[model samples]
Target: MPAEFRAGERVRVRAGDPAGHTRAPRYVRGQVGRIVECQGSWELADEVAAGVAAPRVEPVYTVAFAAGDLWGEGGHEVTVDLWESYIERAERAERAGEDGS
Candidate 1:
């Protein structure tokens, strides 16, 4: 019921603006990550996403990105705290669909 998301899963930040100051950076958009931890659920904070006052609590996940995966060799491994709504399932399914051919 908490919008199922699990660790070791890859996700990318969704489009649209989120209210308040968040650690999820714009450069992180479309960046792939592996869920490291789940923070359960809490009232959707106005600062977390575009402030619309959505009463539903948004689950939070700690996503880890490889330095090389995100940036070039100069980039560091960044573990970002992302909301459940901000993520999309990885493209593995899409690739699988292509592989079926």
Candidate 2:
């Protein structure tokens, strides 16, 4: 399967504050990072999170985020595999009330 997200791309970790179930870690919320690799699509781990029983096709992307971009440099550099379901475009013009990008 071709990876949905490519390298050198900045993807946003999904922010689930009101609706939808996700497996993204809280530490990664609203953070920006560059893609390292695509781990293909897999079943969503939402079942392990809450009572949400929706299985989703989640593409995994290896990402590296600077501590300054996320929290601060005082924190160590963090790398994580984020799911596509938990990923979104930064400054999403569509989600930003513009065209549906």
> Which stretches of model 2 miss by more than 4 angstroms?
18-21, 48-54, 74-76, 92-101
Q: Can you tell me which runs of candidate 1 are displaced by over 4 Å? A: 1-3, 15-23, 47-54, 74-76, 93-101
Every candidate's CA RMSD: 4.1, 5.9
Compared with the true structure, what per-residue lDDT tens digits does model 1 show for residues 1-101?
A: 37578887777677666556555578677777778989777665545356655555788888888778666765667888777877888788754664494
Backbone atom clashes (below 3 Å) for every candidate: 5, 0
C-alpha lDDT (0 to 100) for residue 61 of candidate 1: 87
lDDT of 2 by residue, 1-101 (tens): 45677887777776666355555678888776678888787766765466557655667788887777577565666789877767776665633453344
lDDT of 1 at 90: 76
Per-model TM-score, in order, reads: 0.69, 0.68
Relative to the true structure, how large is the alpha-carbon lDDT of every model? 0.72, 0.70
